[model samples]
Target: MSLPPWISEQLPENGRVNTKLTQRHVVETMYQSDRPFFSLQQIQQRLKPDVSKVTVRNRLDDLEDRGIVATDPLADSLTLYYIDHPESEWPLSPAGERALNRESAETGNPFREFLQHPLVNRVFREELLRSIAWAAIGLFGWAILVSSSGQLPATIWTVVGLPILTWASLTVGTIGVRLMTGNNLRVQSTEGLDTISLGGVVLGGFWAVFLIVVLDWSPLVTSGLYLFVTATYLVFYKRVIRPRFDASVED
Candidate 1:
């Protein structure tokens, strides 16, 4: 396959010419594909049979380091790679421009562009909204239970608090991971966040039990208070935090 002239121009002319050529081939293949993401094995299989998996892996790592590609943090076992933005990263040759224009014309989906915008890319805005919906459903169920029984069940707090707690933990854990990694917006692995979130759930459950048994607080009051806190947090996320992220992308 003929590579774009721009890609050939970027290749090194040193002793590592063959290696760079191979890497260029890998990149050109990724750039030409319609798929947004590809696993190591998939790329290797698509290319010449002689191309080794190690070669493909190394090339992908190099591309990612150069900000030409991005990977999914949630993907486990097999790492996925996708072009970040070829138009911005590389000076596109005429052929490359034609290919991109053709792909855009074929797809003809304006909404996809909005979804790919940096403001919406890294942040879990949709996930946050979904979590709120789940918590609301849980809250509705809790209310019905309280009305029918006239008292909170011992396990009612667990059911009512779990969604909000999970969402809270995920939000806090994501921020904590970003801070710890010094990325401030993105983290390499979500394992730390997941661990923190699980711990929060356990601690939250215990705290709810403590409030019920030791303080003699009504479960209704405790549950209402938890829901109230969650509502406040949701408002803050939508009004304050989300706008900041959106503004950052705009800038």
Candidate 2:
């Protein structure tokens, strides 16, 4: 029931009292709400008549920065925010600390810290941006192949089929891991390396040889298609698989 420590700083008798009160109300609403998450518009609506849209957004941003809240960002839906441990006395709980550390790592370059904006940081970390990048590569690669070869290459199957197979295999592996361990599958290096990606590499190597020799496909085309397949797999994983996986984990 106490104001979050970060927002509880003593303010002199001034206009700052309103700011402190607004911050208290924002955190209280998030902590007391039964719903697990809320969108910006939803939070603003709940605080109707007292808080303006800009004021609500500003407080939410402040709360996030101080590690009092977390976000559930979806590619297809509005990014939602929530309080993970409203009962904790400390504003930055263990989970909140981890989130803060991850955000700091993502927005690196000591000199650019002053120049970094919250909106820019959020956009860069968004799965939607990554999805768009993969889609652009696929579209441009197909266009180039068509323009150079005067038609769609028959080897397109090698590109499309491999990604479909790899993605499906990864999805199955992810489900198995989650079912057994109740954790999201994570990519690691060396001894802790992700098995699914490792398997994909070995399989792709064999498939590449077959495509180049047995099917008479050019080495360049085979390699290019392999890259396309990787992109395709990422597009599917980031936009589809990841969002669902995260949602399930949260639930």
Candidate 3:
């Protein structure tokens, strides 16, 4: 029942941390655990000396009172707790839902809020695997087509057409999915596309083009490298950036 090293590392080494931090750790442990629910003693054991049993109990009561965690009382009178999702069987109260949304928006990171949106979650949850498969297939076909074409034209297309097509497809396709699902398309935050991010997007396209056309690299090789970089970024985001997001909750 020991806490994971990553979770423990984020906490203080000395006396008690604040209740909200304790709550976040409790939520994070449940998130990382394979088990869906943990009893009070089980949660206390996992958290150990970093958070006292009394503090864990208080936080659990607060989370339950706020409807952020659902509970089941056993015949033995032990209560089990699990973090509540929006679609959980025991629905979150209107106030709970509002508070969750407010906390996310308060982070001032639109991309984060976009990730938290229920509609976005619903779309990705159902379609992500399928879309990934199709994307791979499409990329393979594009590589073959480019390989067979005239070198100059292929390079030009790879440099110009590919970026535009990719941008259009992702933007339109995401909006299309939401609209087709009978959901309103809400703009989460354009702040994500601030100068630095937009600059990176532009520079990335030019860099790929430079490698293919000026350096005389094959379109296939250039495209593959671009995809590899993209995949690496996604892996880094999921492994590193996401953990911080997961552990954060507004006090």
Candidate 4:
């Protein structure tokens, strides 16, 4: 295919030749025979002495800045670069090809551009880090209560029940942020209200469970508190809290 109009007009003979050659080198190195993406470092390594890692990154950045390449970064922040246009001319993964064709037909970008915002990305990162801490502290405290209370399903409750729920929220949120923001905010506001709220709920749940098993509080008191706390989480989870985190990047 012919070079794009701007690329042809602005770049010189030697520079144009070198760029095309480099682009080919990058493309060939990044092509995964079986999948849609590769790590930026892996692509850099493939180039060896031909180019430095920073140079490879800079080149990739230039291509992206020029709108010649598309980058899809995964949960861990490793990027997968692909040629965005000329889908038929470039190697396309089944998924990549489908996304391109659909976008080409849809007459709009489905996810929106806000996903690329840097602040949103930082918030997501902070949020995820806070979430891990919250979950860890929560699970540790809950496990202590369950073990101390002589509760039923010791293994299940401690091993699967509490921790799994916490992690599931984290994993799902990570994906949800990416889908919404197109950027990884990964920031956690940690506002006093949020901190107090999250801590209160987890602690309340733990104590409520403890009261039921160890303190022998009346079923009305024990069960009511547990149910109340659970309901508290459910109501806010779907509404007040989640929207704040929508499209953030937290790992």
Candidate 5:
């Protein structure tokens, strides 16, 4: 294989990529590190002043579009990025393979370490699909209630309530899951927890609301249950979910 033409284009000869140090620093770090893949946020840690993760991600997406990088979307919506070069020395055509191979030899498996998550694989499949699933579940559950008929005939309440709850929960869950997954991919690639955070507490609270207020729920009851469940979730989150997740990642 040959080096993709765009690869040569993205990394212009020294002194040409003027104006920004962070973008240049990112490229240099990738060359120096032996990781098959890295996240925009993970790459940010190598910077001196420490730019925001959002900027890093935009740069990454730009690099990918320019054919200087490639991404493998992982569980929980995290994307793993690596330099793009075709096979050359490895009987392929590119030099990027060398970096990836050296990374694996030192780091062990890359992909396997990416899949572990409380959110699961389906969540990462696509944002749209996950939304649809939550909508379906919510709608179906409420329809069931409506069919039963009762006081205030909340049958409509659930049919309406569940979907509304699912939509809200799905939004928060997607954000949390996506961030967590990205960090996981980063750890697996870079060998540490430089990218992941433990703020699923916000999401746990969001999910707790969904559970408590689907139907036949008073505000007091909803608030009470939300706090109880949120605390329980936080406990499991810090202890069970987060740890198991990190344990699955490398170093």
Candidate 6:
């Protein structure tokens, strides 16, 4: 398949024009095709059969290193490769280019680098809103239950603190889960959200029992503590942990 002119423009003029040409052909085939994922052999079969396996492997590695492609580890001991960015979007979209370039310069913080890209920021905001809505619903339901029992605290904490804490927890929890799973936040997926929701429910239930039934902390104190702890952790995550981890991972 013929590659786009822009693809060539994106590559460096480092006297590897032939290598770049071959890599461009592979990208074009993957981008233009309907298939979601391809094995190394499948990619080679589709390309000029004379191309050495080493060349194909090296090109695939290069694409992945550039964040243009991702690898999926399968259960059958075989790995599949596919474009990492959204299929509907071009791999070399302006936002992607900016992300790739920024990632190299901003080695200190991966999360910050991630937000610098418009597409990644958009996805993060959309998912964050969804998580906040879910948190609100959960808090509202809990409020209703406490009210029916006539044990609802007559304070702003129950009304305001709960929702805020839940929202923050869900958002942070989602990111933590993604980091644990080694999934890139740039490539949006629902699996992280699902995992967060399930974990939230279990943890929320335990927290409620401990705070209300066991410790019996006052509503105001609970709210103050929750806000303090959550804020502290978030600050640490954004300022310290994220940057440290981001620096550790290679681009």
Best model number under lDDT: 6
What's every prediction's RMSD, in angstroms?
Answer: 17.5, 19.0, 15.4, 18.5, 15.7, 17.3
Q: List ranges where model 4 is wrong by over 4 Å.
A: 1-21, 31-35, 75-77, 86-91, 94-251
113-186 per-residue lDDT for model 1 (tens digits): 54554433434564465457556655654554454453565464655575467557766566456434534343
| Model 3 agreement with the true structure over 1-251: per-residue lDDT tens digits | 43322333333322122333455567666766666578888887777556667788887776666656788787676777776665457544546545665674586677775565555555566455445645654565456556656753567677456655665576568657664664533312333323444575567677688668866789998888887886776677668755543454223
What does the lDDT read for residue 35 in candidate 2?
69
lDDT of each: 0.59, 0.57, 0.60, 0.59, 0.56, 0.62
Runs in model 3 lying further than 4 Å from the true structure: 1-21, 90-251
Candidate 4 displacement at residue 149 in angstroms: 99
Per-candidate TM-score against the hidden true structure: 0.31, 0.29, 0.31, 0.27, 0.30, 0.33
Identify the runs in model 5 with alpha carbons over 4 angstroms from their true place: 1-6, 12-22, 88-96, 99-251
- What shift in Å separates residue 161 of candidate 5 from its native position after superposition? 92
Mind giving the per-residue lDDT tens digits that candidate 4 earns over 67-118?
Answer: 6667887768677776655545454785775576567548745355334334
Model 2 stretches with alpha carbons more than 4 Å out: 3-15, 18-21, 86-251
Predicted candidate 6 versus true structure: per-residue lDDT over 127-214, tens digit per residue: 6776867686768766655565557774688777777787788787776665456344441223443455457555655665567665
Q: What is the lDDT of residue 137 in candidate 6?
A: 74
Q: Candidate 3: TM-score? A: 0.31
Ten contiguous residues with the weakest lDDT in model 3? 8-17
Better candidate by TM-score, 1 or 6: 6
Pick the TM-score winner.
Answer: 6
lDDT of 5 by residue, 1-251 (tens): 22222343354323221234434456557656766567666787876554677777776766667666677777676777776655432122224556655664477554554454323343455555656767876776566556545742665456676678877788667757665653322233222332333344465455456545554447687678767876786677678866765555422
Comparing 3 and 6 by TM-score, which wins?
Answer: 6
